[model samples]
Target chain A: MKLRRSERMVVISNYLINNPYKLTSLNTFAEKYEAAKSSISEDIAIIKKAFEESGIGEIETVTGASGGVIFTPGISEEEARSVIEDLRDSMSESNRILPGGYIYLSDLLSTPRILQSVGRIIANAFKGNKIDAVMTVATKGVPLANAVANILNVPFVIVRRDLKITEGSTVSVNYASGSSDRIEKMFLSKRSLKPNSRVLIVDDFLKGGGTISGMVSLLTEFDSTLVGVAVFAENAQEKRDRMNYKSLLKVSEIDVKSNHVKVELGNIFDK
Target chain B: MKLRRSERMVVISNYLINNPYKLTSLNTFAEKYEAAKSSISEDIAIIKKAFEESGIGEIETVTGASGGVIFTPGISEEEARSVIEDLRDSMSESNRILPGGYIYLSDLLSTPRILQSVGRIIANAFKGNKIDAVMTVATKGVPLANAVANILNVPFVIVRRDLKITEGSTVSVNYASGSSDRIEKMFLSKRSLKPNSRVLIVDDFLKGGGTISGMVSLLTEFDSTLVGVAVFAENAQEKRDRMNYKSLLKVSEIDVKSNHVKVELGNIFDK
Candidate 1:
C-alpha cells in the first residue's frame, strides 16, 4: 500500500470521495500507506485545497483522541444550476408528454449520471442539516432515494404502497394518493427507523402532495422528525395545500392535446 | 482553475473515480488545470500505479486521435470475498428469518456504505462484459441495480410487477411467482431500453429463477442480448432447475421454527 506523495494523494482523495461524511484517523492512512502521521496531515492539507477549489467537497480535521478528517460532499451553485437547466430542457420535449399528460421521467431518473447529479443538487440544498435517513416510496423513488443516500452517507427507507411478506412488522398510515385523491395505506418496516430519528423525505415527482404528507405522518408514527422534503419534479398546475418542500424541476403545463410540456427550474434554486 | 501538480492529480483522480469506464483525453485535463499534456500523462501514470496497487481499478491508455484514458472499476479477489463474507454473516442472523421462512434483507440493501461495497463487488464480477444496462424488478431490486449501474456508469431499467402511468407504454411478459407457483406478469417500458442492448440482469434474491427467466425473455422480446445474471443472494433449498448466474451469498436454509438462516459465500467465489 506504500505510494509516492503524488500516488498517495490520488488514493487518499479517492477514499474520501467514496466515503463521504466519514471520519478516518490520520494514523489509519499513515499506517496503510507506510507514511508518517505528519506526512498524512500534509496530504490532507493538499487534498483539502484541491477538493475545495474543485468544488468536490470540504475536508474538516478534528483534533483530540477521536480526531479525524470528515469529507462532506458538495456541489457548486453554478454546476447545480447547469445540471437543472439540462434537466429542464430534457423534460420540455413534446415526446415526454404521455397520453394522460404524465411526463415520462423514468428514462431520466433511472440514468446513473442524471441520478447522481440530481442527488448532489438535492443533497447540497440541505447541506447543513443533520440527516439520519432518506425516505421515499417504492418503484420510481427508489433510485432517487438511493442516490441521495449515497451522497449523504445515510440509509434510505422505502415506504411501500402495498404490504409485502418480506418486510417484518410494519407501521401503516393512510394517505391520499396523488391524483387519485383516494386514501391509500403506506407501510414502513417498524425496524427501519429508530425513534426520534431525523429523516429527509424524497420522491420522484410531486402532484397532489398527498404522498409526501403521508410520509410526514408516518414519521410522526415512528416518533421521527422530518428534516425536509425534496422531489425530482413538481406539477405547478396541481392545486393542493402548499407544503414546504424543494423540487429540482417545476412542470408548469402539460398539454396533452398539443403534445407539449413546459418545465422550469424548481423552487430549490430560489435564492 | 489552475492548480499545482498535487491538486491537479487529486481532482483528476476524483473525476476518473466518479466517471468510471469513461474516456477523458489528457488535453481536457491539461486545459482545465492549465497544465501541459505531458504533465497530465505523468499524473495518470502515478494514478494508474496507485489504483492498481490499491485494487481501485485499471486505467487503460488509448492512444491516437481518440486518445485518452478509460478507468475500469475493479476489486481484488480478497476484497470481494471479504465483502461477501460480511454479507453472509449479516444474512445469517437468526432474527432475519421472517414468518414462512422469508429472510428480511431490507436493512442491508438500504445502507449506502453496504450498497456501494456490494455494487463494486458485483460490478467487478462482470468487469469484462459489455453491459449496456442493468435490468431488475421493482422495489427491492431497484437499489441493487442502481448501485451496480453507478459503478458501471450505465442506466438501470426497472421491470415492474404492476404498471404505473408514468412508465408510458410497456412490453409485458408472464412468469411464475417464486414459492407461490402462481403466474404473474412483469412489464418494462418500451423506451426504457434500446434494441440490441447487452443487458445484465440483477435482482435482490434468487428464488425459483422464474423472475430472471422472465427478464431474459423480455430482453429477447426487445431484441437485446443477455450478458449475464447476478443476484444478491439465492435460496439453496428452493428446488429449481440450475441456471447460469452469479450470487454473492447462498442461503442454504431458512428455518422459521428455529428462527435461523444459514448463509454462505456463493458460486461467484468459485475458482
Candidate 2:
C-alpha cells in the first residue's frame, strides 16, 4: 500500500476518524500501510505537523517502542449541523418507520451515521454553555450521552431504572406514566451530579415528557440547573410542556392506534 | 463575542468533535458565536473549504435560512492513535477511579470520556475493514457498540439476555460460564445479522470468553465471519481456549478472592 501523500492522508484521516478509540503502535501503522516502518513514522510526523499547523486536530504519540499515534477528538459546528439535517430527513419518512404504533427508532439509533450526526448536533447545541455534565436515563440514552460527552471532554451520568450495587447510595425520583400505574423511579448516585451545576439532559425518544421531567427533578434534587433537553425525536404536536427543548425530528403524532405516524424536522434554528 | 478566525474554528471544532451526533444550523452557530450572521457564514465557508482542500474533513451546508454547516464525518489514523494515547495517560491515574473487588467497568462504560476513548481505540483497530456491523450484549456493551458503530458508519446490534420483546422471535445460543454452573442463553434477532457478513464483537469485560464464544456461535448460525473481538479490559492471566483478542487494558487476575488489583495497558498491539 504505497500511497501518495494525499492518498495517505485520506487513508490515515479516515482510519483515525473511524477508530477514535485506541492508540496504535508504529508497527500497527506500518502493518496497515504496508510500508516501511520508517516511512510510516515519517508520514505520521507530517500528518501531525499538518494537523497542528492547521489547528483542526492534534496528534499524541506514546514514548517507547509499544507507543503509537492518536487523533485528538473533535468535529466542527458546520459538520454537526449537516448530520442533524440528514436525520431530520430520515425521521420525516414516518410512514416507513411507524410499525405497530411504535416509532422504529431502533433502526435509526442503531445506524452509525444517524447516531454520529445526532450526537454532534447535540454537542454543538450545548457548546460553551459551561455544561458540567451530560445525563441520560439507562439503556438507549447511553449512546447519545457518550457521543456528546466525548466532544465536550466531560463525564456522562446515567440515571438507572433499577439500582446497581456499583453506583452506591442512590437518589431516586418517581414519574407518572401510562404503562405503569404506579410511579416509576429513576436513580442516580448522590455524588454523581454536582450541586448548582449546569446539566444537559439527552434521550433517544420522548413519548411523554414524564421521564425527562423526572430527570429534571432528580437534577434539581442535586441542585443542578437544567440547561436544556435534547431528544432524537419529539411528539411536539401533542404539546408537551417545559421550555428549552430541541429535537432532531418532531413527530406530530397522527394516530398511534391506527399505526399512523407523521414526522418533520423540528425548528432546529429556534433557540 | 469578537473571536478570531482560529478561535472560532477551535470552539466550533471542539464542540463538533465532542458531540459527533447531529447537525447544527447557521443560525445556531450565529447564536453560539454571537457574531454577525454574515461573518459567521464567511468563517464557516473558509473552514469548510480548508477541510475539503486539505482532505482532512468535509463541511456540508444546507441552503435556506434554517440551514447551517456540518463536518462530514471523518478522521485520520494518526488522529485516532493520538487520542488513544492521551486517553491512556488520563486513565493511568489510580486515584481518580475507585477500585473494587471486581473490576467495575460499569463506571467507565457509563462515563463519556472513557467510553469515547475506548470507541476511538476500537474504531482504529478495525478501520477500512469490511465490517458491516458491530455487535455487543445488553447493558454495558451498548455504549461501546454505539461508539464503534458511530465511527465505522455501520449498525450496532444488541443481543439480549431475555426474550423481552413478545412480538418478535429470536435466535438463541448457549454459553458455558466461569462463574455459573448453568449455561447462559444469548439471544439475537433472526434478521439482525445477515449471512456471510463481517462482524466486530465487543464487550465491556472479558473474563472466561464464554460470552464471546457464545456470540461466535450466534455469528456462525448466520454464516457471518468474526472480523475481530475486542474488550475494554481482559483478565489475561486466567487462560482459556480463546486467544488472539484485543484489549484496551489488561488485568492479570490476583485470584478471584484476593484484594489485589493489577491493572496495566492491554497489549492491543500484540495482535
Candidate 3:
C-alpha cells in the first residue's frame, strides 16, 4: 500500500508504538509502504525526533546487515511523578480503608489509563536491563504484570495459587501468606516460562514481601534469573526484611478507626 | 512544547491511537502544540484518512457544544481472519491437548502481540456499542479482559472463584461448573464497578458458558447492562445451551486419545 510521506510516517509511527522494544528493518517498511529505503530512513528520523521530543520514547537505529530500528516506550520524570502523586492522592481517600487496615486497591489497578501510566513508569525505571518476561502471582498481580509486559513487548507468566487441569504440569513453591501466616503453595505451569529467562516481577501491592520472595524462589526452580521487582503500592508500615524493589506508591498509614489513610510517592523515584 | 506541523501530526496521531474510544477537543491539541485550532482540525483530517486507509481505525468528529473527535479502532477483514487462523493452527497442535480434553491456552493469552490483536478483533466486533467496562472470570480470563479494556480505554472487572481480603466487600453468585457438574460461587468486588455501567464480558475459553452467565447475572445485580460477550475460543463439540457471544476460534473436536484437535474460525466472523 503506497502512501504519501506524511501518511507513511503516521502509520509507521503507529506500528513502532504498538510494537515497542522490537527491531524492524527499514526495508520491511519500505516494501510494505512501497517507498524507497532512503525514504523509509527519512521517515524513521522524523519519527525518532517526534517521539523523543514528546518523551513518548526513544527510537534506536541499529546499523548492520541484520540491523533495524527499535522503539523503547518511556515517560518523562515530570509526568511519572505527577501520575504517582495523583495515585497517592486517590489512595489516601478515607473510604478506601477496609476494616482490617487493608486499603482497597482493586479500582485503581483495574483502570486502563492508570495501569498504562504505571506500566510506563515501572518499565522506564528498568529500561536498560534485558528483560525476557514479566512474572506475577495469581489474582491481583496478573493485571500489573500484564501492564508491564505489554510495554516491554514480552510474555507474562502468571503463577497461580491453585492448580487447574488446563495448566498441565506445573512447578510449585511454598511461601508464607503474610496476611494469614499460613504456608501455601504457588504454582507456575512448567511450560509457561523458559529456562535462563531474565524476568521482571510485578505485583499490585507489597507488604511482608512473602509473595515476591516465593516468586523469586520459583524463578530459581525454573532456572530463570530475576532482573528486578516492582509493585504498584507498598505498605510502608509493615516491617520486613529489606527487599530491593521499586514501588509507585507507599501506604504509610491506614487507620481504620479514624478512617484515615496516608500515602506518598514510593521509592521508584528515589535516586 | 511547540512543534512543526508534521511533528505535531505524528504526536497527535499517537495520542489518538493510545486514547481510542474517547473524545478529545481540538482545542486540547491546539493548546498542547501551540497551533491554531484550524491547524489541529486539518491534522485530524489527515490522521483520519491515514488511520482509515491503513485500517488502524476511524476518527469521527462529533459536532456540537460538547463536540470533539472520537477514534474507534478497527482491523481489516483479512487481518482479523489471518489472526484467527494463526490461533486455530496453534490450538490444533496435538500436544496442546491435556488429559481431560482441555487445550492449553496460557501461552497464547500471555503473548502481548497476540493479545493485542485479539483485543482489537473483539472490540471491533462490538464497535458502536457503549462499553463502559469489560468483565471476566479470574485466573484465565483476566488478561483477555484486560486486553479488551485497554483497547476500549475502559476499566475491567474480574469475577473470582475464591474470595480474598484485598478485594474488600464483594457480591457473590452461584454458577454451575460444567466440567465437574457441580455448583460453585463467584464473587466480584463491590467497589470495582459502578452501577448502571454498560459492560462487555470477555473470557479466554468458553466450554460451559456458566461463567459468562454468572457474570451476566452479576451485572444485573449491580444494576449494570450487558452490552455483549466475546471469547478467545469456544468448544464446539461440548453441548452447551445457546449463549449469545462471539468467539474467535471454535474447537470442533478434541480427540485426546488420537492426539488430534479440529479447529475452525468461530461465529465472530459470521455476518
Q: Which candidate should be chosen as best, given DockQ against the real structure?
A: 1
Model 1 off-target regions past 4 Å?
A: none
Model 1, TM vs. native? 0.99
Task: Give the Å shift of residue B109 in candidate 2.
Answer: 3.6
Error of 1 at A114 (Å): 1.0
**Which pairs clash (backbone N, Cα, C closer than 3 Å) in model 1?**
none
Error of 1 at A252 (Å): 0.6
TM-score of chain B of each: 0.98, 0.67, 0.97
Local lDDT at B135 for model 2:
92
Ranking by lDDT: 1, 3, 2
lDDT for model 2, please.
Answer: 0.68
lDDT of 3 by residue, A103-200 (tens): 88888888999988988999999999999999998888998999999999999999999989999999999998886469999999999999999999
Docking class of 3: high
User: How many clashing residue pairs, candidate 3?
Assistant: 0
Model 1 C-alpha lDDT per residue in residues B1-271, reported as the tens digit of each score: 8999999999999999989999899999999999999999999999999999999999999999889999999999988888889889888889888888888999999999899989998999898989999999988999999999999999999999998888899999998787656999999999999999999999999988999989999999999999999999999878776689998999998778878788988889887
